[model samples]
Structure formats: structure tokens, C-alpha cells
Target: MGAMASRGFDHIDTWVFDLDNTLYPAHHDLWQQIDMRMKGYISALLGIAPEDAFVIQKDYYRRYGTSLRGLMIEHGIDADAFLDHVHDVDLSTLDQEPRLAQMIDALPGRKLVYTNGSERHARNVLARLGMEGQFDAVHDIVAGAFHPKPTAEAYQRFLASHEVNAGRAAMFEDLARNLEVPHELGMVTVLVTAPGEGEAVRESWELEGREARYVDHVTTDLTAFLEQLHLQR
Candidate 1:
């Protein structure tokens, strides 16, 4: 770990973690299911082919921060229905990580799950990981009024709702772009990376800028990172 990475959480009283890949290993392919569902939903909604829908999905995700957002803006799709459909994936593939649960529990102060997905999906994921009730609160797309992360407005709304001091907080996210706003807001930002490659869930553009100055830390294993913090404190 670098110097900043080692001591960055010393003053952090609030730990905000992104769901999906950030909480669980990306190799599990859980998000891949959601990604496919998203494409399917878009294809069915627009009466287009899957490949064509995929292009629009990625384009929307790149331009609007989320595909659902783009769909709403362009086609007036029902956000709730879209979220429900996309998140309806099998959690049986995910195994409970007791070590991760323990490490997260050991952290001091408030813990929160901030996700662009629905609260129901976040809860299901937590239950699958045996981490239910570990977080003080969950701020989902509904809570943010459909504004997703990487957007300054969404971050501001989250901070205001939680009464969190950005300087004393730390955020963990799988996507580098999602951490940009948190870093700019003075939160210690940790980019959680997964092993292997050729994952369709995350795009090449989404994984860009991993070495950006805004990212304070980067870790491939979230459990080990938290364990190190436990020892440091």
C-alpha cells in the first residue's frame, strides 16, 4: 500500500461502499447477468435486436451515467420497472463471505451502501453475502431521485441526506469514474478492482483512468484492504 492508502482511513468516520462488484468479487459474474438483462430489457422495449440494444445501452451508460437514465430521458421508460427487471438475477452463485463481513463490522462508525441500483437489489445482495444489517443505511437510485453517481448533484444529495462530512469519509467503488465526484468532494476514494479480463459487465471506457490522481487507493481484494486498515488502526 502507498503512504496515503495506508493512513487514508485514519480520520474516516463514515465508510461508503458501492454494491455489486465493489462488495463481491467480479469474477462471480453476477453483474454479467444484470448486464445481459439490461440489454434484453432495452431490446424488448425498443423492439430492436440484442446487438443493437447493447450499443444503445453502452451509449446511454456513457452519456447519461446509467442506461436507465438515458431511457427515461429519451423514451420515458418506467425507471422502477427497468431497475426491477435488470436486478432480477440469481444470487445463488454468490457465497457468503464471513471474513469480509467481519472486516466490515470491525470498521468504526457509520457504514453505508450507495448504489445506482434499487434498494431491494442492494438488500438481496447483502443477504446473499451474509452482510445484511451491517450497513447503517442504503442510498439507492430512488433515494437519490434517479440521479446516479459521478454526478456532483447525486453526491451532494447523498451527503446532505446522511449528514456526512466528505473530508472524514471514505468511499469504495468498482468503477473509477464513480469515485471522481467523491474525491473532488474530499472523500478518500478507493477503487476496487477485480482479477481477469474480458468481462462484458464493465466496459473499456468504464475501467479507464484507474491511475487518475483523484483515486487515493486501488485494491484488487476488498477483504484484504479492510484487514490492512484493521491492523493500521
Candidate 2:
């Protein structure tokens, strides 16, 4: 048992997974709660309607890697408060997926959760998925000093903190652009996303069309993907 072979993932010794949509399916609708909270926070901060705030929020997310970063830069808002408010969504929509847990357990190498969200949010999502303690670490936005994905510095800091060798690592994320830096850094990049999810929130920075050079693999079903690798291994 060595790996899927076709993907040439045999050399990957570090498996870094994104939380939220990557670890759990988009159908769970967990992101919707956070999305609502972000708009609410923005509306309150700017004294605008939720509808207007939503438009600005997404524009910020597109211009900046994260809406929080945009708020901090443009308005000098409190990052800690924004994080807490946006992540205060209910996790009732999420439930444990035993198959995913089993699949993650079978994978070889060190596993870690790398998210632009806060650790508290990651913990809630992981616990809801019954994946607590499975990952070696949860590197959140705070760990990256509030610099979110698609930002070179965040990736650099994460790799240094973990002492990770990018050449021997693989990153699984839902967004396409987030994988670009990883690919450039010599890490295999996998885009885990569905068409509906991609269309709903993916920004212009996300990979368009079929020429996904930065993405080494694409999978709609994370559990099945991992299972196939495990079987081949």
C-alpha cells in the first residue's frame, strides 16, 4: 500500500486540511451562519443595512484575503472583536461524519488544520465533526497575525511555526487561490469543493476554467478521495 500512485502523493508527509467547507460538506450550511454574522457585524459597525453591508463585506473579502483584514485596514476596527462576533454562529447544523473521521485516521503523516478563521471557531467545527484531537495542530488567523490565506506571509509563518517542509506536504482547501502559494512553495495542492459551493462564494482570485496548474487534485467528496488513497496504499 503506497498511495494513489497516479497523484504521486507518496512523498507527502504533512497533510494540511482547511476547516469548514474542506473538512465538512457545503450542504451542511454551517457557513451560512457565519456569513450572516459577518454581515451583521459590518452593518452594526458601519450603521448600514444588512443588504448594503453584505455587498461591502464581500468586496472587502475579495480585495483583502479576509473581510476582517479589510476592516482592520480600512477602519482600524478591532480584529479580536470582529472575529468573536463573526464566529459566534450556532453549530447545530453540523453533525459527526464517522466515515470522514475514519478516513482521516487512516491517512499517513502529520495532520493539521489550517484556517483563516479563529481557533475557537475551528474547535467548534472540529468537535461537531467528531474530529477533536485528531489533528496535530490548528493554525488559525491569530497564529498568522490576522493575515489570511492567499497572503504569502501567513503561509510563511505557518510553515515556520510547524517546521514543515513544504516539499513533503500537501494542502487541501476549498478555495482555488489559497492553493497557489502552497503549490509555489512545493506543496501538493488539492481543491476540495463542489460546483454549487464554488459558485456561491469563490472570489475572482479563485482558479477559473480548467487550467488549474496550482491544483494537483480536485475532489467533491473528501471522504471518498481519502478512502481511495487509503485503499491504494
Candidate 3:
């Protein structure tokens, strides 16, 4: 939260967040479980080896924003089953981050989570983080009609449904590409960088913020970032 970063988010009235790596540190190792579950489900569904499934999963994620979306389009797979199986991985690794929760609570305006995952998954994560009731709403993939971030449709849907003034809002996400639409829509975009979680296209997908102009701010420490904003307030 340097002067520039603080000014970037100072006028935002709606705070949109991407869950997963954005809220919790990447070193927490929670996403590793989810990534494995996704690979397992893909392997079992397509009758392929884990290694092959891994390749397909990453490819689909890059091409369609989410593997489930790609599965639906290419294989006619049921979205619900995929979401359930992938997100059912253990959450025992996540610990309540009170300071992170405090940073969020202290922020002014409406808070919302717009994740590519399901409402159940979002709730579980929030509960684990001790911030379950903090959000004004949870806009999941279901709310996005199976479209994920980087999809203009999903962003439009979230804004319309929540009655958010995109120009007066800010979006914080772990993935750089996901911030593109938010930036185009006139929202301040913050990229939350985390450690390598070893996902399908993680390397290519993670660090694009450095070169992407859509990213207005970048921070590895989300709690500290938000805390600084709070202190400025």
C-alpha cells in the first residue's frame, strides 16, 4: 500500500475479489489438493492416465478459462459433478487468517467474491478463513452460468446482478488475465501474486501481471496490502 497503490483503490465503492490464491497465501498449500482432485477427475472421466489428463486439464483451463467449461463444450460433461468432485478436496491445510479478515472488514463499501468455483466451495473457503459472513454476496460459476473470469459475460452478469458501478469499483485477483476485463470496465485492478501452486498452466497463467498493463497494482502480501489501505483510511 504505497501512496500510488492506496490512491488506486481509494475511490472504489465495490470491492470484488477472486477467491483461492487471492485471499490465502499460495504457500498455504491448499490449492495443491484442489489441483490434484481436478487431475484425478479428468483422468477418471476421460479414461486417460494422470499425466495425460494433466495435459488436457491445463490446456482446457487456458482455452476456456476453466476446465469444467472446456469439458462441457468439448465432452458434454455435467458442470455440477465436476465442480463437486474438484472442490471436494481437503481444506484441512487452510487456517483462519484473522488479520486478512480484519483488513477486509475495515475496507469501505460492498464486498463480493466472484470466483470460477461454486457457491459451496466459496462458502467452505470463507468459513475456513473465518470470513464467511463478510461478503455482501458470493457470485460463483453457477451465478456466471458456467462462464468464468476473463469471460465478459461473467463480469457483466456479476455487475448487473450486484448492481455494481464498475467504474467506481475495484477487483483483486490472483490471475493476471482475469483482471483484464475489470480494467477495461474501468475498475482498479490488483493482482495478488502467490507462490507456485503447480496447476495445469500455472507458470504461464500466474505471472502475466508484470507485463500486462491491465494490472494496476500487484502485491504478494494481500493482508498487508489491505491493512495499509485501512491505515490510510
Candidate 4:
């Protein structure tokens, strides 16, 4: 194994988890609502049909980190306003079916929430899912300078800000590319979401990652992943 790929699994003292689909299931159609809202925002801004706006919006999200980023750079829109619109999608759908509080309580060491969403959004989602008290730290997109996933620089920033020893840490993300730098940085990397879920959101299970590159392990469901965790040392 390469040097960066080895630090996470055995020697790490910390665990970093991605929020959004990694914590829940992407198949819940969470992105559908967000898509609708994004399309609405774009259509209102550019005077286009919602359908065409949606197509263009998807292109932006796929090309730039987020459609909001593209809008901010190209359309000169307010970042805060865009964030409010995109993240305001309905979250009432995230259920307690995964009941992860006990599993989190049973976790062995320091656990941190490293998400691309805003801190408030992360807090709300966690609260809605009954997992509000599980993590040691919460890092969000605003704090991270709007540079969310697949960016090695952001992960470096995350490590620097947290005073984390990357060599002694593990990171769990549903997005494959997000795990790349952590793996390269010697983190114990765990890919928490399954395949075929497209990468609509930052690291949503709906997206696909280049698993052959940096992924350490793969799990179809977070609940099942936690179940197997208890049996391990």
C-alpha cells in the first residue's frame, strides 16, 4: 500500500464522518427536493424554464463544486443567499429508522463531523435524525471557505484547523473523491455509501467515486457498517 493509504485504519486516533447521504441513505430522494429548489432559483434568476434551468444547474453542480458556486462566480449572486436557497430543501424526510445514537455512543474514540453543508444545516439534519450529540466537533462549508468536497486543500485545512494528526486519524465519507486526500494523507479511509448512488450532493451516496484510487472499505448502508463495527476490536 502507498504511505498515505495506511495512516487511517490502524494508527488513527480520530474518526471523521461526512454528513448528508453518508449519515443517511441517498435513495431517500433527498436530492430531488434540492434539485427542485435549485431549478426554481435558477429560473427566477435567469428568466428560463424550470426544466432548462435544472439541466443547466446540474451541469454547474457537476462542473463546479456547486451550482451556487457557479452562480456566485458567473452570475455575481450573493453566496449567503444562494446557500439559504439550496440548503432550505425539505429535510423532514430523514427518518430515525437508522437509530444511530447508541451506535455512536459505543464508538471507540474521538469522532468528528466533517461536512460540506453549512453548520446550521448540519446541526438541523443531525437533530432531525436523532444523532445530535454524537460528534466531538462540527466543521461546515462556511468555516471551510465554501471549498467543500474533492478538494485536497480543504482536507488539509480541516486537519490544520482541528490540529489533527492525519497519520493517526480515520475519515468516513460517502463520496469517493473526498476520501482520496485523506487516504493520501495517511488517514484510515472508509467509504460509507454504496455504489450507483450518483454524486448529486457533495458526498451523497447517489454519486460514484473512483474506488480503485483511494477507497479503503465500502458499505452499502451506514447502519450495517456500524453493526459490523461492534464485532471488531
Task: List candidate 4 segments past 4 Å from native.
Answer: 1-8, 97-99, 194-210
- Sort by TM-score, best first: what order? 1, 3, 2, 4
Better of 2 and 4 by TM-score: 2
* Candidate 2 structure, TM-score to reference: 0.93
Candidate 3 Cα outliers beyond 4 Å, as residue runs: 1-7, 195-201
Give the per-residue lDDT digits (tens) of candidate 1, residues 32-94: 899899999999999999999999998999998889889999999999899989999999999
The CA-based lDDT of model 3 is what?
0.84
**What TM-score would each prediction reach against the true structure?**
0.96, 0.93, 0.93, 0.85
lDDT of each: 0.90, 0.86, 0.84, 0.74
Question: How big is the positional error of residue 65 in model 2, measured in Å on the Cα after superposition?
Answer: 0.3
The order of the candidates by lDDT, greatest first, is: 1, 2, 3, 4
**CA shift of 224, model 4, Å:** 2.2
Task: State model 2's lDDT.
Answer: 0.86
Best by lDDT: 1
TM-score winner, 1 or 4: 1
What lDDT would candidate 4 get against the real structure? Answer: 0.74
Give the per-residue lDDT of model 3 (tens digit) for 154-206.
Answer: 89999999999999998999888998988999999888876443445366555
Query: Could you tell me the TM-score of candidate 1?
Result: 0.96
Q: Which 10 successive residues of model 4 have the least lDDT summed? A: 1-10
Deviation of model 4 at 157, angstroms? 1.6
